[model samples]
Target: MEEFFKKYKIELEKEELEKFEKFLEIFKQKNSQINLSAIRDDNGIIEKHFVDSVMLNIFLDFLEIENPKVADLGTGGGFPLIPLAIVNPEVNFVGIDSVGKKLKAIDEFVEELELKNVKTLNGRAEEIGQNL
Candidate 1:
């Protein structure tokens, strides 16, 4: 994890690190009620969700997009969207999920993290993308 942060120092933020941890906790609690994610284990969440999500910063940097608008298609439980939003507060992030329960979890997570540039929509990306 330290290596991951060191590799992408410019995009990572201290506040985002804190929010990522909080997001993990919230996912754990919400998992009991709804099947938001298939990976219910802590290690899985940390690796597949948290780490993978944060890694998007590297992609953004590679693209040389200073303030790109990102859409996380089928962003179940806010994977690769919430963490990316936290790390790159300057960028806009929109999470799309058809599951109401999952969207609810994402809304709660976004509110808890006090994110301003992140939005959650309860629908499929295929349907939304056509309108865009």
Candidate 2:
């Protein structure tokens, strides 16, 4: 897993790699039971979900804010939200999804990953946007 990230020129610590490993395990275990996503293969998840998600850090790394807060709309299976939160522990993340069951899986990911900088919200873009 670390090799994959390194191939993409994404640097990560040993602890962060461990979290990503556990996160993948949890995702696979839960996804089989709940059918949380259509992309199942390891490379698919890695290239599409994990690496692709963490790659967003390139943009965030330039942010000048003291504490950055990011939102991932339609965050099915936690996608970029989980990956980013793991890599960027200083940045706060809120993953919003309309599917309540999916959000439950994200909650599990958050707890299992022991991530302190992440949160999940159950709502749609328009509905949530109207309120905020």
Candidate 3:
């Protein structure tokens, strides 16, 4: 994972990097209990989930919003939202998923990672978006 970040020229603080490692550990453990992801191996998770999620940073310059508020609809297993929140702690992230079990697992992941800027909503995107 560190190599992946280095490949992209992204420097992560030690603490931040540890948090991502912890997230990956917890994700794998929970995934075994629930179908959080189909990619079971470390390399697959790193590339498909961690790297893929952090790819959102490429669009950050275009957003041009300080402390941007991001809503990830149908954010299964936290996906881009968790990784995005991890890298950009100042930004706010709201992850909405219809699967209650998945949301529960994400809640646990958020707590384990000690993420302060993320919140999960257990509801359909359409219904939740309408109310919001």
Candidate 4:
């Protein structure tokens, strides 16, 4: 996974890489208990989930916001949101999903990763967006 990330010039620190590795393990375990993701294997998770999510880094420069806050709608199992939050600990992230169970899994993932900058909401994006 570390080698794969380096191929994209996205060099993760040792700790960050460890967190991503841990996330993969947790994701697989949770997926076994509940349908969190369709990509089941390690390679799939790395390529389809983690790498895909990290690709959002390309837009970071365009954001042009100091200490940016982001909202990811229908962030099932915390795809872009979790990975983004992991890499950018200074930024804030909110992940909203319609399924309560999926949010629960995300909450567990957040806690397991010891992420302080993320929050999860179990509701439709429209309802939550309006209030925010």
Ordered from best to worst TM-score, the candidate numbers read 4, 3, 2, 1
Off by over 4 Å in 1: 1-12
Instruction: Tell me the tens digit of each residue's lDDT in model 1 across 17-71.
Output: 6776788788888887788788998777877777777876667888887668998
Model 3 lDDT, residue 91, Cα = 88
Q: Per-residue lDDT tens digits of candidate 4, residues 1-132?
A: 997788778889888899999999999999999998888999989988898899897897577899888999999878899998889898899999999999999999999999999999889999988887
The whole-model lDDT of each prediction reads 0.80, 0.90, 0.89, 0.91
Report the Cα lDDT for residue 33, model 2. 91
Q: Whose TM-score is greatest here?
A: 4
The lDDT leader among the candidates is: 4
- The number of clashing residue pairs in each candidate reads 0, 0, 0, 0
Candidate 4 steric clashes: 0
TM-score (C-alpha) between model 3 and the true structure: 0.95
TM-score of the candidate numbered 4? 0.97
TM-scores for all candidates: the values are: 0.84, 0.94, 0.95, 0.97
lDDT of 2: 0.90
What lDDT does model 4 reach?
Answer: 0.91
Residues 2-109 of candidate 3: C-alpha lDDT, one tens digit per residue: 998777677788988999899889999999999999999998898789888888888975889976889999999889989989998998999999999999998899
Cα RMSDs, all models: 2.6, 1.1, 1.0, 0.8
